[model samples]
Target: MSDSTAYTESAKILLLEDDLLLAMDMEDYLLDRGHEVVGPFGRLVDALDAIPRNELAGAVVDLNLHGELSFPVIEELQARSVPIIVCTGYAELPEVKTRLQGLPLLPKPWTAHKLSSLMEETFGATQEPRDAPPSKIRN
Candidate 1:
């Protein structure tokens, strides 16, 4: 697939994941793809706060964040018509199936390519966001 980072320049991405390394890696990955990535946020409140005020194009969310499932955030994103992709390592996919129906659910340890493509696919190329190489950008 073409590097989705090309579309990143036009999309404001909100990333909510608690795993610090994973979050940071994804943030860097998104940055490299040229999309505006808000936060690899580990907290629900922080994510909730950041998503609305900004002109969000889409998001990649962790199903479990700091012992809290992301149902509420899903609701908010759905309400706002913001596209979201779920990333999780837990086995409770069925439990959250209702809220996550029809959305991309990327299991843990996913490829950077998949991540970037999903962002581009979700938001399209209309809206744009700040793009630059993060301190670290993995191939």
Candidate 2:
């Protein structure tokens, strides 16, 4: 599909996943859809550090990052009021269910179509890109 077909406007999405291959695939998909991807951070500390340094339109975060729970990342995104979609294989875990009660959960092995749809739903169709200065990580 063409990059502009799904949504007229693109967004900057933060990606936090531990699996290198999976992260690359997701980054490619987001890029193809005309969205810029922030860190596909495999480490919790790195992901946390990137948060404040970037202006994120939304986030797609895995629940686990190298055996560490990503609750802090989720909390930080929530605090910023940035939309998040938990793309996790551990959605059924008690801790995940309890902690991420209302957040959207996109189970692992997600389809591009589903991701696009959910992104549009969460962020809407016509987003005006933020006027803030470029993200430090990008430079």
Candidate 3:
């Protein structure tokens, strides 16, 4: 595992992904980078439920959870002002383009280095883990 001393601060990051192996990979990578992993939620409902329960510095959301679209989860995160990174294997559909107009889209099959770079760019440098104050999710 890589050393965590490189970061100045750590963050609690929510992860919404349906693929078990991929989720694990991402969770491990984030943890290795010294950030707390909230959930590798495989279902949309679970991801939605997690939003209000944890204070997240950012989120990595897959465009689809199982067969269901994850737009609601994305919207909720946006409403809360939480930064987000969307990943998808499918082509950029019109809806995706519309919903994620300015948000970062991490295409599938990305490397850990790419993820690490993006995470840093999105959430800033990682640091030692710290407890975050509770935050509420807006309706």
Candidate 4:
């Protein structure tokens, strides 16, 4: 069996959602599940800045933020070979789909359970929870 404990302890997740309420809920959920939440960045610029410097295991990104397309952010994350789950309302937007191709798209109105399962599948989660609080870098 895989070492679930070690997996959870080391994985750091990036969250790039503009919705304040949703971001808070996601951050809390990820933190409760034992992973470090790198950012609940409300804007694309902040997310782009963090992605290159931070040691991210994976990312859950919203395609549209503050009425702006987040394609550049997605491209940067993809360039770094960071696994991404596109959590957005614009999943059907042909432009976005064409750009992303086969990346996982988890539509908006997501549940903690669904997000947790995705994390577990992508990066693995453990029974153990982290002691430090989840981080937030909104701008």
Candidate 5:
């Protein structure tokens, strides 16, 4: 996976997960796959603010962030038609099922392979710029 040829057009992806360790790992994986990451934002407010500022092609979102439901973040992304892949441990929550019907949902403890594959399917081919470092939106 060192080569970027297999990735979809280099797209900016929003990462909304609260766990520091998990977010770091995901950021590394997305960067390795040639996608610019907007933020591994721990707070929903931070992620929501970054959304309007970046041109996000897709997202990997967590259902709960530090105990708060992230429905507003999901809805904002939905309104923009940016593809989303929900990555959370709380997938069984009724609100998750009700609001995010039909979207891809990858449970917690997922592999980098599963995440990348879904991203590829959603965004098509990842573009080159192989040497470019992945970017992040800091707030």
Candidate 6:
């Protein structure tokens, strides 16, 4: 949890994308929202290495990094029980599809409001129309 009074709070955001401009934009946007954007990493390997260390409440991911699929990074975040938001220009593979369950997916060229709403839903900040039954994670 973060301090409510903090103007700019901290969250460990692991973003993997090769596009330098996009990476910087995401980092800045998340930071402005009072989050600690950890890596706007352009490489898959560096993003993978950093995922396990942060106290993350949420994540936003670009599905491909430097021509490599970022499924491994998603797996690591899932293992840590962090809620993740995915941004993809392409369709997800079988592995990512199966692992995602009913989580929301935001395609590329999204607005800030969409990202904010989805992330809020993940963080228990939004109330579902009907109460969702509490579920447990196996393994």
Please report how far candidate 4 places residue 62 from its true position, in Å.
0.9
C-alpha positional error of residue 39 in candidate 1 after TM-score superposition, expressed in Å: 1.4
Runs in model 4 with CA error above 4 Å?
1-10, 126-139
Query: Residues 47-99, candidate 6, lDDT per residue (tens digit)?
Result: 77776665666767887776787788887877777677888766567776776
Task: Estimate, for each residue in 38-130, the C-alpha lDDT of model 5 and write its tens digit.
Answer: 888999889999987877778899888888988899889888788888987777779768777887887889786677677767666353335
The regions of model 6 sitting more than 4 angstroms off are 1-9, 92-99, 124-139
| lDDT by residue for model 4 (16-101), tens | 89999998888887777666777888888899988867767778888888899888888887777777888887777787678768
Worst 10 residues of 5 by lDDT: 1-10
In the range 48-108, model 2's lDDT, one tens digit per residue, is 8888776778889998887888999999988888888998888888967988898888888
Report every candidate's CA lDDT.
0.71, 0.75, 0.74, 0.75, 0.77, 0.64
| Candidate number that wins on lDDT, 3 or 4 | 4
Best by TM-score: 5
Worst 10 residues of 1 by lDDT: 1-10
Show model 5 residue runs off by greater than 4 Å: 1-8, 125-132
Model 4 scores worst on lDDT over the 10 consecutive residues at: 1-10
Q: Report the lDDT tens digits of candidate 3 across residue range 1-139.
A: 0122132345678888889999988777777666767787888888889887777788899997767888999889888777888988763788668878888778898687767677778767553333543322222
In angstroms, the error of model 4 at 98 is: 1.7
**Candidates arranged by TM-score, highest first:** 5, 4, 2, 3, 1, 6
User: Candidate 2 vs candidate 6: which has greater TM-score?
Assistant: 2
TM per candidate comes to: 0.78, 0.81, 0.81, 0.82, 0.84, 0.73
Candidate 1 clashing pairs, residues 3+ apart or interchain? 5-33, 8-34, 8-35, 9-129, 10-127, 10-128
Q: Tens digits of per-residue lDDT for model 1 on 1-139?
A: 1232233353677888899999988787677666667776888888888866766777889999878898888888877777788897774556667657788878888786666566556666332333555432111
RMSD to the hidden true structure, all candidates: 6.4, 7.0, 7.4, 4.3, 5.4, 9.7
User: Candidate 5 at 123: error in angstroms?
Assistant: 2.0
